[model samples]
Target: GAGVSQSPSNKVTEKGKDVELRCDPISGHTALYWYRQSLGQGLEFLIYFQGNSAPDKSGLPSDRFSAERTGGSVSTLTIQRTQQEDSAVYLCASSRDSNQPQHFGDGTRLSIL
Candidate 1:
């Protein structure tokens, strides 16, 4: 029940709907990252947070995708107006620093209809 945990291991949503996925990172970890892996694709970084470092959302596919970290520990990723192209395994990881090897949790499989 430690390390990292993600909610709604599986989510089914209709296209154009909004959904939120939560991530609980390891205690005391200062770096958190959001990534998504589509079928046969490498992990794609969406955003990252480390201490007060500004988050990098350059990898976010669209404005519909956003994330926020709270207390520098828990984070939530929200996808608005989800589309079929957004369907993928959303993964969350955290590390001691941005350059550290992030520990990942079983991702939330989002299916958009």
Candidate 2:
């Protein structure tokens, strides 16, 4: 497909476990973004990467959350010591540039027990 794709569309894990979610962006897209959706929390931008370089990571809430990109195409979001509060829908979006509109993937639904 020529759009963003995310793996493990749904995940169920116990509290304190670590989880890794992956996202593959459309071909030739240089900008990728990660966002989280929680009940009452709304859509929150987590991080962004441009051409394998992340210029703004301030959106990441804590050290337990981190992300990285490889070959400027794929990105992975890792959460350490997952908590029930971490349960949310993690979304991935891609754009040609910051000024361009982004296309999103079906978010990965994370459930922490």
Candidate 3:
């Protein structure tokens, strides 16, 4: 893909179930980010991975959320013990570096029932 790619455009799961979302960044992008956006709310940063450096997970809202970037190309975000409040659009973005402009994927819409 020319741009960032995300899988499972929509997800519906039970409140206590877990879900994993995937993202494939551009070929040479060194920075990847995970964000969540609730209805009518702005994007909430979740985590960031850059090259071989450790990931910055400071923006994660709770222990239930976690993400990993493998081989500096693919990333996955996992949400455990999901709750209704966790419903939102999970977005993935990539950039050449921290200071570069990011290209975003369409996002995976998650709905907790």
Best by lDDT: 2
TM-score for every candidate vs. truth? 0.93, 0.97, 0.94
User: Residue 91 CA error for candidate 2 (Å)?
Assistant: 0.3
lDDT of 2 by residue, 1-113 (tens): 57799998999999999999999998988999999999979999999999888999988989999999999899999999999999999999999989999999999999999
lDDT of 3 at 106: 95
Residue 81 error, candidate 2, Å: 0.4
Candidate 1 has its poorest 10 consecutive residues by lDDT at 50-59
Q: Which numbered prediction scores highest in TM-score against the true structure?
A: 2
Off by over 4 Å in 3: none
lDDT of 1 by residue, 4-110 (tens): 89998999999999999999998888998889999867789899888645468788899898888878788999999999999999999989887788899898999
Instruction: Please give the clash total of every predicted structure, in order.
Output: 0, 0, 0
Q: Report, for every candidate in turn, its global Cα lDDT versus the true structure.
A: 0.89, 0.95, 0.92
Q: Give the TM-score of candidate 1.
A: 0.93
Looking at candidate 2, what is the lDDT of residue 14?
99
Ranking by lDDT: 2, 3, 1
lDDT of 2: 0.95
